[model samples]
Target: MLKAQETVLEIDLKALKHNFDHLKSRISSNTKFMAVVKAFAYGSDACEIANYLQKLPVDYFAVAFVHEGIQLREAGITKPILVLHPQAVNFNILIENCLEPSIYNVKILNEFIATASAEKLNDYPIHIKFNTGLNRLGFSENDVDTIISTVNESTSVKIESVFSHLAASEDLNEKDFTLNQIKKFKNITENMTKQMGYKPLLHMCNTSGILNYPEAHFDMVRSGIGLYGFGNSEKENKNFKPIGTLKTIISQIHAIEKGESVGYNRAYKTDTFLRTATLPIGHADGIGRQYGKGKGYVIINNQKAYILGNVCMDMIMVDVTNIDCKEGDEVIVFGPETTAENLAKTANTISYELITAISQRVKRLFIGN
Candidate 1:
């Protein structure tokens, strides 16, 4: 393990490759893979992660905004990048950088078409996102005619792919709903292709979707959380390794006598003599206040030290009375043993929330080349 002066998020590139290979093995041989590197690759350094995957030679990359794609382009990532949520103001930048936009609504589609025409671009690749069941984004299935008409009117831009987000591909109870979504996507794509005279690549699966519904792999599949080493299920999680480990060190230890209080607002009061260790991380570092007051914990010397008081913006106190630890000892906030999934569950959240919530201030160390 690398030494840490304070808090650090260690990213294992070897584990990342293992996850990519494992997820790739689950999909069809011809199906292409797109790595979702949005939100700084889920807060683990998007440039570095994407750069690493670029060598792995992923078929495509997806980001949530135009600035993210620009960052990757600046970093020399030449793969086709899909901007999932793009704004008109950044449409010109997207065009200059050759980043494709996922046109979910007519307004965006029209705006992008106008921009592409102004730029004198020919056959500019753009993706069409359908609403399917995730009513968050995408055109409604009922708007198929409008979509076809809009594309037919556009000569500068061409639909390169048609995709949708699965609402609940991970939940076994929602199997029927997932199947229905797949069916809807197929029908919408078929109708669009017939009208356009050429079929764009069709994809509708995310990480969980790929693992649970392989039959709907279509032309390509996207892997986000799964690429970061989570399966969204216990069975599949065993086959992958977590790529990130958040660790910190003990800054100081305090001996608290009975009736003594700890941390902001005196959230924890000692009933007996105790030893408390202060860690140099708290809500500001993405260890939110909700995990304070004895609800969350850290692993020290293979022992779980429960949080004893409220978490501050820069510090947290843990009950380390039983553990024989000293200042500078390594403390694991979440890692292989203390999985991010388990930690998020203790806070009544999910692994995605915890992993992505890691603050950018924390230094990230890449290991396992």
Candidate 2:
């Protein structure tokens, strides 16, 4: 361990376990949990996170790409992994690793089926994603017949689960839309299962859906953000603990007078006698340049320090004026006190984007209870 001495993402596995246990408390004994570990486990460390969760015995794991699953497998993660959006080109690699693929369209389904048949594979698990409301990457409801036909003809493949994505399950304003998606998903699953003469596991709820719409918990729930310690709302029980803390140290401090500029392009001019500190983080490390120029901030000595100017690729200057701070002092980029959700609000984006946007170059230190 680096002993919290540098720009690091401190991951609280205790909080993660607590979050998982809390979310699991909402469902019954039958509803399995699938932890989503895509995007480097939300910019923390997928292999480490996966390894930890495997010890927790989560029912399954999910990744966004085939290579991500492969990465986990190489890291000694033996749990069943579902590849959310696998490319057809990597079908062989996916099969070689015993990784399941999510088939969203008939073309990919046919291609996978052919690959399985050619390899003489038996019992290859595959999930079908339907576009209930999130039309980003899923089969249309109208394609139920085509989906059923494809499943019926595929002898080498075994249907594992049928799932969908929720676009706005976190917002109560979109309740009607989420309900509509739930109804459509249920209807499609029922019709398809009846037509195909086999009932695969059905799942549709993301973290928000699992929290806001418990009725749609289905057979399994795919949780990403909730597992990372963010609930749909702080009002939603307020029990979900944040699992990641981004901490950095002040590299340098400067005392400036009025009219003195700071950072790239001299975007910010000190209004009064002030003290500023440069953080060892910026857009290149996923702080994002849009958050610069006084728009974003960091917390030092329990005080908020506004960004002094444009966020550089490797550094950001903060107006630590009037605060008791010094070089090598710990600075909070985002954590329990300065949450990623709050930071996202500052950047006019969502927490999902904020967490996922964190670059891989940042060191991540994992901790347990």
Candidate 3:
């Protein structure tokens, strides 16, 4: 085990593998799995996580943009990487690095085809993204015919897969909408494949979709949060183990008398004498200001330490009076006892936001490889 630092995110590779194997067991043996490693693997060392998953031999990898895929490539990730959102400006780089681009619209499709043709590339792999119900970054269902025609015109690029996003697969209340999305994606892919001579791979399920909509797990499935140990539901969360633990140390302790304030703007004032501990972490470290003033807390000595006042840029004061701890003592901002899901709930957010917000400046210590 690695020693705890002043502030570090302890990443457990064993937990990651467990989650991977668990999710993998849920899918069919023939179904391909693509691990989403975008946003630095949800802000937990993308290179390290991708390297580990590569050994698990996931069928593919995905990232939100071209630069992220490029970073993975630079780190020696040889697995086929699908850039979820690729711009025309980076077409050359994407081509040079052999990174597949998810062509979402007419402009991107046309531009990438033109660039690929100019580069004399042949049969280059490209994924097509349909909007379905997400209304995000994808071609609308009505554009399916146009998309097929455009792909047919491009001799340099070949469609590797057709996929879409689920807007609310995690919400049980949105089951109808999620099912409708799956149906729409199915119709789009079927129509495209019928028109084209060959059938490309079909995939639409994300992490939540994989858990809730097994019937829609087409030719492949993509997992992001699930790989990092979250299932978007209480029951499913219990089955997976969170792999990242945000930990820090108490920098100092202060004894404040009655009516004294703590931290900036006097957001927290003491009614009586109380002890507070200053931690070397704050909004700049990804614990946003909204989490301060009792909204968020930390775990010390197996007790909760509420934020005393407004979180500062690089420091935060926590009410540690009741807890027995000293300077340099270990503090779990969020880990096994206080999960990221719970911390995000306290801040009125989700685990995705909290985990992804962890800053690059904070060190990441890998354990249990």
Please give the CA lDDT of all the candidate structures.
Answer: 0.92, 0.88, 0.92
Segments of candidate 2 deviating more than 4 angstroms? 1-3
> Which pairs clash inside model 3?
none
Residue by residue across 166-220, what tens digits does model 2's lDDT show? 8999889989999999999999999988887778999999998888899999899
Clashes of 2: 0
Which runs of model 3 end up more than 4 angstroms from their true locations? Answer: 1-3
User: What are the TM-scores, per candidate, against the unseen true structure?
Assistant: 0.99, 0.96, 0.98
* lDDT (10s digit) by residue, model 3, range 295-324: 899999899999988999999999988899
Q: Residue 338: error of model 1 in Å?
A: 1.3
lDDT value, candidate 2, whole model: 0.88
Alpha-carbon shift of residue 344 in model 2 (angstroms): 1.7
Ranking by TM-score: 1, 3, 2
Ranked by lDDT, the better of candidates 1 and 2 is: 1
lDDT of 1 by residue, 146-196 (tens): 988887887898899999999999998999999999999989988999998
